[model samples]
Target: MANLPTLGQRFRRGWNAFLDKKAYENFNIIGGGYSGPNYRTILSTNTEQSIISPILNRAAVDISMIPLRHSRVDENNIYKGTIDSGLNNCLSLTANIDQTAYSFMVDVAMSLFDEGIIAVVPVDTSISILDSSSFEILSLRTGKIIQWYPRHVLVRLYNDNTGQREDLTLLKSSIAIVENPLYSVMNEPNSTLKRLVAKLNLLDAIDNQSGSGKLDLIMQVPYAIRSEQKRELAEKRLAALETQLKDSKYGVAYADAT
Candidate 1:
């Protein structure tokens, strides 16, 4: 007979499986409703963790305080002079018009920390989308991707002035995206911080639903459930109450009795 897998082998298999997982997918539902991916729940959870995880905020703030960079990190400066003037002007400002470069970088860091993904989208172009120089530039916006398509992506832009979210569909060629930064530490299903955020999300959900429950709802029936006839009446009343709750537009049930 073939021997069963040893304990070490079984442990290794389980660990590997855990490491391969992406997300626990806890964002789909919150407060008994579908929470679409504007990342509200995740952000709410991250905000709740500020006290416990102060370092996260501190690090984010420090990094965001740094000015935006025109060239790559530690990139050879030899090619800096060769860069286009229009591109240089464009680099002076962030792609996001709603935000200054400071806030743009901050939001980018915050979004990565909270949602694990972000995008820089080109919303307009000076001459053509392909033009690189000659004092030409398109506009750029920093935002998160809500949906992806074959040739285009649906992005949710942050509007600071109006404090309202705006979504745009932009071509794939002009978008720079970073997904799942520090995946193992920040985004993986079983990672410590990821698990912490998931747990925080669960707690935040519970907190939001704490007082918004059916506790205030009360059902009344005149008869007891002891006898067969009374049981039928009680069931009917309960069913009617359920139907009333379901049929109402705002979960309000109306009844009249003399």
Candidate 2:
């Protein structure tokens, strides 16, 4: 009989497959807000139009949009600082953007940056493509040249279809950049299996650690509430992980390995 793959091997396979399927060319958006709804719209639209579009040949574009929450200086400063602090550390700062919406644009951008999937940069209003073939972005703000060699580029308009004609110039001059084409995918919640596995993995990690260390780490989380509440939550999560680990169908392999 063929040997069954170990849990570690399965995890590695899953992780590698996820990365291979998720690879994307870099993208920079000219204008957009970073609100939760805005991020949802962008993600949904991109997934529908670019990632899964039949006409586009299922091309993946790694999108990085500048946040409208800060001014030019502030935006530049924030991005530069993030770059300096190292991408992995940016998760802590994302809570400052918005906790109520955990997966907002800023959070997604930070996650992408962490994965080295894309870069987030600030540009002034009078931005234009210098070379379509080479994918050069010229920032009138600082006369600096930003080069992006993505398979495609797209412009997201806030409102009004009248301005699309003028924006078409920006699209025509650029490689694959185009004004918003009205298209979308049917929104669906994540699969229960995926969500369960993610939660189980997270909780297991915490549970395996020493109690004091886990509590210290939980307390350091910016969005986490009071100490007692955090402790209770950790206990509950650990209990849940234990329960799932006991399940034969979902976690038997993992539990056996541990």
Candidate 3:
């Protein structure tokens, strides 16, 4: 089997391939939708620690795809899913970073299951489309399926004319959590419950880091596309975080943001 690659590595490879194929045009500047001359393949994996199989490595992915409609369908080739599915719909995708025996199937199922989600239009987040659904989440490039959640799905549609994915978050607001003070005290006094809380906090921290990294990537895409500025800023930020991770500074321990 092919070896696995980190998420960042996979992204780098995908973007590079996109550059080589001049796939930018496939992304319409005016028209909202993704056009395809063809498709491509790629792989991902965890590090070598589990090469012996004594350990298990689970790598989960989130996917998002732009949906196409009647006019969206290419004149040359056609898609097999819903004929009425519009170009604005997303196909969610996901999978373990490690290639498991059923990885592909599992990922596809998740995407298919999450095919439709109701949310405001991406173009105008303020305008609610009670009948419309969010784009099915899928692998950014491969269109693989991951897990699906309606609340989590944000409607992002491409403007056929502009080729830009529209954001509708402003049209509606993300749900806010109102934490109860007692909830925070449930695990107090250093008990197993506290330990669990600590673990959860750590997981949340990791997720936040991953999320910020993703945003950083998006912000730096212009530079990446040009292949001009070396990702020095990103690298520096990573180096700082690497030091913190080594020091076990992530998670919930250590007071005050370093």
Candidate 4:
């Protein structure tokens, strides 16, 4: 053990030692190119060997290399901007790095949601007690208003002129009203790419709304895209939150609450 180093020391040594390493050479694919194999390679030399590798751990250093693959060319096939755009949107998210207005807005919105800033509005109609003159009356109900308090207003519709009987069908319309304000904020053309920027900002604002106070029924915004990556990110975040809940010693963490 005279020469042996501790894990921490070894890790540091590996990181420092691997600072200069050549990773890729002869970066070419087989059976590629229009005329012949269009090959490219970093001819290994003192110059190539000087390239650096990233230290990952005490035992591992990270270096990236081009993969060898067969290439095909078809004359009839045409390459179009549409294909590029599609690839940029789906397969390559980096395409939108500069394109998206304020990239952090999505993260801000998601963080707000993760921090219990999200609110859910129940679409189903149910019985609600309305007090009029200290007397409860069944009335035709439309919806419960959701907004910032003190300034927020709630308007309920009743079935009869006397407001005695409650109508549940009208309650479904509540969801409709909840969404309008968000769109209105998005549509305001006071800023850059106003609508899209507003939509993204609105999401962040909505998520932060729950932090202000208690929320009964509120609107939930849609995600940018219901993709597998988004789902996996959500699942991982939820798992982390669950682990924190377990550590908190809070009795019976409710999965349904998330």
- Identify the leading candidate in terms of lDDT: 1
Instruction: Evaluate all candidate structures by whole-model CA lDDT and list the values in order.
Output: 0.61, 0.34, 0.36, 0.32
Evaluated at residue 84, the lDDT of candidate 3 is 33
Whole-model lDDT, model 1: 0.61
Candidate 1, residue 116: lDDT: 73
Winner by TM-score? 1
- Candidate ranking under lDDT, highest first, comes to 1, 3, 2, 4
Better of 2 and 3 by lDDT: 3
Model 3: lDDT equals 0.36
Q: lDDT tens string, model 1, 1-258?
A: 999889998887755657755554453331233234232323535343553346656666787677544453335544343344444444556544445555555566766776777786555556655454332444555677899899878889754334456897866676688775574464334456556667888898888888565555566665456889887876777778779888888987755451
1 against 4, candidate with superior TM-score:
1
Q: Kindly list the per-residue Cα lDDT of model 4 for residues 137-198, writing each as its tens digit.
A: 11111233333344333333222223232223222322223232233332223444545445
* Per-residue C-alpha lDDT of model 3 across residues 90-133, encoded as one tens digit per residue: 22222212222144333332323333212222223232344444
Q: Which pairs clash inside model 2?
A: none
- Candidate 2 lDDT tens digits, 232-254: 76666656655765674756322
lDDT of 2 at 37: 38
Indicate the residue-level lDDT of 60 in model 1: 67
A best-first ranking of the candidates according to their TM-score comes to 1, 2, 3, 4
TM-scores for every candidate against the unseen true structure: 0.44, 0.18, 0.17, 0.13
Q: What is candidate 1's CA lDDT for residue 137? A: 48
Candidate 1: list runs displaced more than 4 Å. 1-42, 46-48, 51-53, 65-68, 71-77, 82-87, 93-98, 128-135, 159-164, 187-258
Model 4: ten consecutive residues of lowest lDDT:
52-61
